[model samples]
Target: MSRVVATTTLWRPTGPEELALVEASGWAAWPPRLPEQPIFYPVLNEDYAIRIARDWNVPASGVGYVTRFEVEADYLARYPVQQAGGRTILELWVPAEDLQEFNQHIVGPIEVVHEFRPQA
Candidate 1:
């Protein structure tokens, strides 16, 4: 069966002080919602794609490869679940044969966290 790998990048204010400021400003919602998990909104530029391809060791053409992104069960359980906010994590499904190749470029700081295989 084929499998899908989900990836995401997490960004936060640079320092605790910044975080405090963000909180104190009242701009930040109190008792943050569970579904408010961060989202990776890639601009999808040629150069960015190339970098991703290089990092994954796949050919540059692989950059535009479309992959489905969804939230994992655990994540849903932990965070407030909501369909809005593109906050769900990124996901990708690839043939089993391509798994190794994908893995080479996926694992690490990018947060390639889940493996989903189709049921027979």
Candidate 2:
């Protein structure tokens, strides 16, 4: 018999370098955060992710991608959703140390849902 897995959808805004790393993982995991990055944050809404990817990442990198994935709900329960600014700007802050374990809880392959590039 098959069992149902509870999952919560999350979105991440990323640049080409990071996206390449994720692709190298066969879309199964997020690459480890850099030494300066103490936390890995995944947003709770697509709109917020889009804003960051378009307004921030694209300007910085020339290209940005919005990725969507699912994480096992039970594993994610330990981290409370944070409101960065307003009600819609919600995200989960997972410590860099815990990212490996967090990656393991991802329900399936990550997918790029949107891409933003500088207007030429």
Candidate 3:
């Protein structure tokens, strides 16, 4: 018999460059963080993801994308949820060193759910 695993949905706001790398991974994993980046933050709510993609990413990179994926709930329990700002701005901070293991816990393909681009 097969066992069912519990999963938690998470969203990440990313720019064109990072999205490209994600696609290059066949949508199965997130790219490794740059040396200066110490934490990989995946937000818990879509609204916050959307806001960051539209407001922060677009302005910085000319385009922004929101990707959603599910991770094993049990694996994710190791990290505490952090409040970045208001109550709804919740996120999970995965240390950069743990990203590889974190990626392994993803339940399925990472999907691009929304896109933002600068207005002409």
Best by lDDT: 2
Give per-residue lDDT, candidate 2, residue 94. Answer: 100
For candidate 3, what is the total of clashing residue pairs? 0
lDDT per residue (tens digit) for residues 2-103 in model 2: 889999999999999999999999999999999999999999999999999999999999999999999999999999999999899999999999999999
lDDT for model 3: 0.96
Model 1 worst lDDT run, 10 consecutive residues:
60-69
Candidate 1 residue-wise lDDT, 1-120, digit = tens: 856545433222112232243346342211222344333222223333333334442332222221222332332332332333243422222334433333244223222222222224
As for candidate 2, its clashing pairs are none
> In model 3, what lDDT does residue 59 have?
98
lDDT of all predictions: 0.30, 0.98, 0.96
Which pairs clash in model 3?
none
Ranked candidates (lDDT, high to low): 2, 3, 1
Best by TM-score: 2
- Where does candidate 2 have its weakest 10-residue lDDT segment? 1-10
**Where is model 1 more than 4 Å wrong at Cα?**
1-90, 107-120
- List runs of model 2 lying over 4 Å from the truth: none
TM-score of 3: 0.97
